[model samples]
Every structure is written in C-alpha cells, then in structure tokens.
Target: MSGHGFHVHGPHDHELEHAAHGNDDFASRIAVMTAIMATVGALFGYEGGATQNDAAMFKNEAAIKKTEAANQWNFYQSKSSKQNLAELAMVLPGADAEKYKAKVARYESEKEAIKKDAEKLEAESKEWEEKSENALHQHHRWAQAMTAVQIAISLAAITLLTKKKWLQYASYGVAGIGVALAGLAWFHI
Candidate 1:
C-alpha cells in the first residue's frame, strides 16, 4: 500500500514515483503560498480593527467637546439675559416702559433660540459617537473571524504539504475555504 520501499511495475513504477515527487513539490509550493496569504490577511485584519477603534475614540472625544461647548454657550446666554433684564427694568422706569418690555422680550427669544441650538449640538455629538462605536465593533468582529480562518488555513496547508493521509482526510478543501474567507475579510478591511 506504500509508494516507498517497493515497486510493482519495474521501470514504469520509477516514472510514476518521479511524477509523485513532482506532485509533492507542487503541493509544498501551494502550502507555502497559502501560509503567506493567511499571514497577510491576519495582519491586515488586525490593523484594520485597530484603526477602527482609534476612529471610535476620536469620535468620542469630538462628542465630549461639542457637549462642553454647548453647555458653555447656554451658561453665557443665561447670565447675559438676566443682566440685561435687570438693567432695563431699572433704567427705563415709567417713561420707556413699553420699549424696555420689547427689548426684554427680544433678549428672551434670542436666549431660547441659543438654548435650542445647544441642545441640538449635544444630540448630534451623541449620535456621532454612537455611529463611530458601532463601526469599531464591526471591524473588531471581522478581524477576529479572519484571524481564526487564517489559522485554519495555515494548518490545512501544512497538512497538505506533509502528505499524511490522515491529515489529508481531515483537511481537504479547508485551505480553499479559509483562503476565500480571508480574501473576503481583506476586502472588507
């Protein structure tokens, strides 16, 4: 049952044996190529995931800045409105009462508009952070899956090159499937 240490067809067996050696070399080459691809895919996936995480962090920082700016604007507007209302009440008295009332009303309206804008900016900051975090999670998942696939492919390639019948039986077609998945992940990254 072994191809080595025995010959049944004399010179023809020698030719067939030489051909099998060539096949073995071809299989080894394939295995090496598969390993290279797997390694590259794993590296790319890892880096892509890390980059996504950095982007998420940046988004969070931006969100924090926006919220802080909005809060500061609101505080400033509230103080200014109160001061203006007090000054107008004292300075106008009975002579320009209606004019003071109109001026105060406009100031109140402007303050309310600024308050709405600050709220809107705060909401937008939260939304941006959430979106960035989601993208980071997706990239992390993709990287993990690709790493597992690459390991599987490397194992399969080793098995194929070694020409162990048991390994072959256990690993046939695995390298192909792993490579395909790796390629898909690479494209995503």
Candidate 2:
C-alpha cells in the first residue's frame, strides 16, 4: 500500500497488460492477418455481387435485342406477304397491273430494309449474350476468390485458438491464392 492510496492489482494483471501492449507476437500476427483477410473477402464479395448484376443486365439487354429482332422479322414477313399478293394481282383479270407492279417493287424495297434491320438486331443480341457470359464468368472468379479468403480467415482463427504455427502458414498460403484469384478476376480471366 502506498502512503496516499492503495492500488490493488489482480493476479492476471501481467497477462492483461501484455495483451494490451500486443506483446504476444503470434497473437498480433494472427489478428493482423485475420483483419486483412476479412477486408479482402469483403471486397471480393462486393465485386462478385456487382458482376452478377452486370451479367443480369447484359442478359436483359440480349433479350430486348432478341425481341426487337423478332419484331423486325415479323415486319419483313408481312412485307413478303404483301409483295406476294401484289404479284398475284398483276396477273389477275381486270386488275391495275402497273399499280400492282409498283406495289410489288415498294414491298420488296421495304422488305430489304426490314431484313437488314433484323439481321443487325440479331447480331446485337448475340453480342449482348457474349457479354453476359463473360460477366458471369468473372462473377464466378470473384466468388471463388471470396471463398478462398474466407477459408484463410478461418484458418487464421484456428491458428490463434491452437497457437499452431503451421496453421498460420496455411492461412497465409490461402490468402495468397485469394489475392491471385482477385487479380485474375480484375483481368477478367
């Protein structure tokens, strides 16, 4: 007891003080490693979600393009039917042959335009489908990266609990794989 006051310290004060100062090197390393892995995992998870959304958007665009192409094709088919009717009118008795010829020509021209537009839309649809596929592939990569990082964090926790040096190394290895996967995802590989 001091003259001014009595300050009683608990028996585990030394251990508590050591922890407060981060004196246990293994524990500090595991803590830092766990924090880093968690951050990386979160980032990977966010990227996976974003990529999934992108894939859905691209797929929707593909579907819209396909519908537009189908409409154009329907218009082309209608023009073909009109042109067939006009050709038949040219040969029918008591019909305006010149007007029918003009009608046929106009329908053919319109059909050509519609065909081109339909083909263009079909190509756009295919492109959108390819984009959607690529986005989905990237999303998978991000998800895999997130999974690896999560595994690493779990390993780090186990290392802290058991004080196993080998588990720490394993955690580091898994974390490296997670980072590599993240890089691959960034490159869209």
Q: What's the lDDT for residue 173 in model 2?
A: 98
Once fitted onto the true fold, the runs of candidate 2 whose alpha carbons sit more than 4 angstroms away are 1-22
Report residue 86 deviation for candidate 1 (angstroms): 2.3
lDDT value, candidate 2, whole model: 0.95
Q: In the order shown, what is each candidate's alpha-carbon RMSD?
A: 9.3, 2.8
Task: Provide the TM-score for each candidate, comma-separated.
Answer: 0.56, 0.90
Number of the predicted model whose TM-score against the real structure is largest: 2
Separately for all candidates shown, the number of backbone clashes (residues 3 or more apart, or on different chains) is 0, 0
Distance (Å) between predicted and true CA of 128, model 2?
0.8
lDDT of 1 by residue, 55-103 (tens): 6786977678697767858675785767587556857546577666676
Residue 155's lDDT within candidate 1 is: 62
